[model samples]
Target: MSIDDTIGVLLVDDHPVVREGLSSILESADGITVVGQAGSGEEAIVLAGALTPDIVLLDLRMGGMDGAEATGHIMRQSPGTKVVIVTTYDSDTDILRAVEAGAAGYLLKGSSRAELIAAVHAAARGETVLTPSLAPKLFQARAKEPPPLTEREREVLQLVSRGLTNADIGRRLFISEATVKTYLMRTFKKLSVSDRTAAVITALEQGLLP
Candidate 1:
């Protein structure tokens, strides 16, 4: 059921200018297509149901439904669709929330058009991409309370840093994929991060990850 040609993108933002600008940027790029657009989370849910775009460019601070809630709904409805969050907020909480919500891409508004295109393609490919750099400053921003990831959590995290999927991790460690997910869930709770990318980013920032 998966096609490998152009990556279909949906723009979700409350601002008219932002949505149009992003569509223009994606359309100008080769191997990418703008399939749909929405100004609110409700509209996005509707369009996503109809269009089922490969990747969604979501703004975090929207009015209703919000980007995080919309992301949850979209993924639940269309398991194959990838949501890429584009916003001005890079706070750890926001980043983690988006990741937990199942967003595969995160980029600030300051990113260049080329970066946006790259992120969209990456998301379409089921890869997570974080713009600019993963630095200490980011860790400082995202880390609160900062109890740190547990020992087992850190071990599983190290494997995650090695770019292994849950199935791969299970096979490598003689554990079930369900067990790997359990570890990941615990790690998610402890680190206060939502998804794997945020976990990796936080680990990298803390020098716990290579």
Candidate 2:
């Protein structure tokens, strides 16, 4: 295809190898050009504005300004650009955040080169792309009510909100540190968050915490 007929893609990932691998795969495909590669979300935002690529393959987790946040910014800066999240995480929270942030597609890193190329092309066409297996999970997560936290889980998160360390919370509650960690893990799962701060923020937003 001609240069103008090709789909321009901007790749965003914290790891150089990941970006390089993705670029190789994408550039090898017909009608898809790897226009730029960003090693951070901040860089992705700048490139998205400057390059105005047709598609952005963004990593979900990064050191600063995660994929979801970057997707939001890219969409606002270049409304015509379609962002497709390319990450290893298939967690419901991760998927929800990306989609809610205006991502046109959610694709796992394990996807085959064909799948990745197809997703880029599809996204460039303004279609929403999602791995078939994850589509149901996304729908279910959207439809289902937020899982309620157990009383002990709530207590753990409440203590976490107070900026207490796990050991400190365990000591205050007269529980073993391992047990405190277990509660935190359960709370994180139920909250669909990977970190304590997010768990607390999600809980507060959902009125699950005071």
Candidate 3:
């Protein structure tokens, strides 16, 4: 097919062999082309700007910038370019981070070539794809009960976790104690907890804390 008819893809992986393998797979697929290969997120961002691929097959873990970081940068640089994370990580945190960073799809490294091709096509068409095992995690992410706490609430809860009193947290964050208390109260209501200790515990269990 012609370049205009093909699905342009930029493969971003740290390993040369993996890139080569993925290139071969994509090359044999119909209407798909490996327009460029990047060895790091930094390079991927640069190539995405230059090549303007329709899709980016990104790896999760790289030296300088990981897939989540790369996805954010690529989407910001080229909003039309879809980012599909191809990685071995299936942890809730990893998947959630990539999704939050605006990944168009998430596929495991062990997925069949057909699945990979399908994911790339789906992503190119502005569809969301996730490994079957990851679907539950996505639901759980959305089902985070009682809604999410604001950044300020999380900061106050983190301070609570560190055994900081309201006065200390207020001083440390350059806010008045009343403001800190306000944040804490909002956090408590969101987490369905009455006290700082319970709020921190709930945040930790929900993976809202770093």
TM agreement with the true structure for every prediction:
0.64, 0.69, 0.69
* Predicted model with the maximum lDDT: 2
Any idea what lDDT model 2 has?
0.88
Tens digit of per-residue lDDT, candidate 1, span 135-181: 34345545656566677778788899889999999998898999999
lDDT, candidate 3, 24-120, per-residue tens: 9999999899999999988999999999999999999998777887787788779989999999988876787788778998899999999999998
lDDT of 2 at 97: 77
Positional deviation of 153 in candidate 2, in angstroms? 21
Model 3 clash number:
0
Give per-residue CA lDDT, model 2, range 64-109, as digits (tens). 6789878877887899999999999998878987897789999999
Off by over 4 Å in 2: 1-3, 144-210
Local distance difference test scores for all models: 0.81, 0.88, 0.86
Off by over 4 Å in 1: 1-4, 134-210
Off by over 4 Å in 3: 1-3, 145-210
Ranked candidates (lDDT, high to low): 2, 3, 1
Candidate 1 achieves a global lDDT of 0.81
How displaced is residue 121 in candidate 2, in Å? 0.7
* Minimal lDDT window, size 10, model 3: 189-198
